[model samples]
Target: MKTLKFKPLVLALSVGMYTVVETSTNASPIVGAELRIVLSEQYRSMIEEDVEEDVEEDVEDDVEDDVEDDVEDDVEDDVEDDIPMDTQDNLVDAFEDQIIMSLDELLEDSDGESTYSDDWLVLADDEQLNALEQQGYSIISTEALKGLGSNLVKLKAPSSFNISKDNPSLALIDSIADVNHVYQLAGRFEPPNGTSFHYNQLLPALSSQQLRLGMIDTSISLEHETLSGANIKLHNVAKEQYSQVKDHGTAVASIMIGQKDGFTGLLPTAQLWSASVFFEHKQQAKITTAEYLVKAIDWMIAENVDVVNMSLAGPPNAVLEQTVQKACDNNLIIVAAAGNQGPNSKPLYPAAYECVLAVTATDQKHKVYRRAARGDHIDIAAFGVNLLHANAT
Candidate 1:
């Protein structure tokens, strides 16, 4: 059996890669050294769509029947009592007007089809179905947007419909009156750099104690050596099989609580509930969608997790924002990577959200990692440069 070694570089609070350092004859590797980290005290904060078609049908039928019966009674009475011809015409016109007004009101109260772009996840009421269907949109799936206590529907556009740059989906979705919000489905984020394998000396085991932690990332290798004694609960919300590579999620998990033989993690006793939202693709980099991420957060909330560690980053999404806010309101702390988009890159979320604690990477000397995102949103820095991590395989 071959044993893999990793060196501790830096700890990325939000998101950044750490490198593994080779050991020298005279200097001891920092893997076993007690890290003196400054903990920041601050940093914390915090749609129903349905249309009842059966009820609408019932109302329509009742209204029509009442109108017809009233008109017939009025006509019969007018004929039998010798009412004037002009009075009879006026009565019929009034009845017709009343029927038209009633129908209009009923139609207004009912949901119509809502229009949206292909890239949007629309939250629309059931009454908007007619308008949406007219615009070539249909519900493909539905999931609970946890904390909001409402279900978010995933909609798809017609196969022939095209969203050109000149007519972006965002603008089209915004024009829709029924849509509460149209959120862009984010693609999977690539893992941090410097993930090559290395050999190192094993560090002594640390004491195990229990802590509630949540992780939203790729599938983890539960049987990995480093995770031998870790209390981990795995949920596959990504709807895909666990990947054999399993590098990203496994490494992140091991860093959180894996322990075997002489190797240890930051929290050997952590009760980790991992929600797998990312999956490895054949030709593309591992990625996740906004829908899966929302589901993962919902699962975390249900588990009553204390802190959530998100080592992934992507564009700002309304659905994600709502979910994060709900998590904070429930007193669950959210820690996200500031992303590896580099110092000049725009801030990524949920790190950018006001309620979340954004973490950047730092080196042994406490210098910021060159690739780590820099912005006012960053709340703290952690070691993530040249850090030794457990191998997934």
Candidate 2:
């Protein structure tokens, strides 16, 4: 077997390439910029059209029933009563699909790998999935169908890599490689020349752990002195649409695990899991789609991770909620941002889930972030407002 190395987010299952999609958003002031209206419109059309089709189908069914019952005292006149019920069911169905699709689209992309031709792929085992996800690969939509008259599972495009057949040694490499270990990244610890109090407080603990960090935003620098002591892992889950320059993940990681010299993170012992899952540099994509997130969480659980931090949010999602719940049940401390879409205080997933620890950011002024989501879902608050960290500097 030829020696080949696997990237952080895209695993090398075979001599192939992959096209991944992920969620992306802008920084504090640019949050709205990340919400691509056109993308949303396409998605909304896809959804509304589906609902309309369902309503028409339901109406026809109602018509048939009414005709059958007409002899029993004008049952046709009672269709109004069923209208409301039909509408409610349709609405619920639409909402569910929207949630699912939003997550899927955010995690997938229109771009594919240069060497391979497949448009999609999925990891089968928990171990493989986690290896991909922590580096920021989330599933959008996938088909795992039972074969004709057989119990065997057949995955759709980008079938799970056949490590044994395609590149068996790659699998062996992952099993033996320590890249998954945080300490391996070389430039992760050194902070920028001009550091802040936050970085000063956090850097040492991370260095002592020998762990590296990965950030998915543009604010942090891969060459910064502080991060120099650590490794700088980057990913473009959104393809060329995004800059691969933003450092939202970097800033957030710095807050949670950034080294000293100036800024400090919550858990200094943890290393960075740097990945950029966005496109067009400023569009909203699901950084870690629900499917990939499940795998990522599982990986963290298996590794017995000390903490998993997420500084992003979106509407409530069932699969995501369940995954976080399972992670917590397994004793992994999951942390998430309270979402910058707040002030109106709608609920956000992971952060709002019962098992997660939701944190809201506060600025230097000690005031809550204007967009930080609020409501009963918010469990705790952190100094997120205009806060400086090693990644930001």
Candidate 3:
């Protein structure tokens, strides 16, 4: 299997990486520390060309060997000052070993690697609730998951614990990972509310050409020029923050319903019920949680959207799978991104789920996109390259 391996620690004398993010293949994420920063040969060539004068003394010592002695001062110094931005590893390595980085900062990057958290979610009930008390675990959060004709508790574990097969970074080997609720459905299952989603009578009658679709992505810009006067209703499903949205949703919404001269969306007259689940992270791009996704899907179901678009890629979750199946049982059609992790990467969900149509990216020439994930689940292809579309900004 193709695995991402970590290098040895740089080992500064005074400080060390207080937290570590370990990279493993098909196992839960582990925290690691003291990332090593290798001084490539280019360090010498660059200094030889750019050095006008040293701060106090010449950088005459070999970049690697002699500098090892003064690593505390030379290496411990904010790394960006000594090294060029283009050459450094990812954001994690550009710091002193002693620095206690926040989870967001440490996870800000990997080496051309999209960063991920090792956090895992477990299904528990009041009797099985292994939810760590705020006093013990690193962090804890809970959500109500409606699945399999019963209510289950979704518990979020800290980075130290993780589970699931799709996100190889997590493992269910921990003791807590085993203390999950195991229930068997007794009688023939009926389903949620014992009914399928039907169009709302309150909604205006639609023409034959009009369709009902749902957008489960970032927030949409209803006022964007392309989307003006379009039948798009946005529901912010974030639990806390009331006003948090981004541009990705706007771009996607434009592609679905926006109609202007020389440009037209696939369903220009479609009635879109958009559920904005993503919120602006403290530092990262807009981020959403599995809970948000479940809530969004539930909202879409209530809205009676015939089809929904999930433009996201990530590890699979049991609750999410259950909710998706529920949606499928309601006769809702789910479409998802085929993922950009390359052909060799593992399948991402909900695209990988049997209930969804995994939509892969192609170009005007019908060639598969260079990074579009290839898998048996990919049921369709769409134009993914080089076209003028609406921008949020």
Best-performing candidate as measured by lDDT: 1
**lDDT of each prediction vs. the true structure?**
0.54, 0.39, 0.50
TM values, all candidates:
0.58, 0.45, 0.54
Candidates arranged by TM-score, highest first: 1, 3, 2
Off by over 4 Å in 1: 1-119, 123-137, 145-148, 158-209, 240-245
lDDT of 2 by residue, 293-352 (tens): 444555555554545555445444333455566666665566555566557966665566
lDDT (10s digit) by residue, model 3, range 1-393: 111111010010000000011111121100121122222344443443333234224544645544644643554355558766656533322332223223343231122212222233443443334434422443345555443232333333433332332233222211123112111100011112212111111111223347787878777777677788799888888754334664556656655666665455555677888888776555444566666677788777777877787777666556577778888888777777767667797887777888776767654466876667787887665555443345564
* lDDT (tens digit, per residue) of candidate 1 on 235-318: 888664435336677767666675665555666776889887776544234656666777888788888887787877766656
Error of 1 at 23 (Å): 12
* Candidate 3 displacement at residue 249 in angstroms: 1.0
Candidates' RMSD to native: 19.6, 18.2, 18.4
TM-score: model 1 vs. ground truth: 0.58
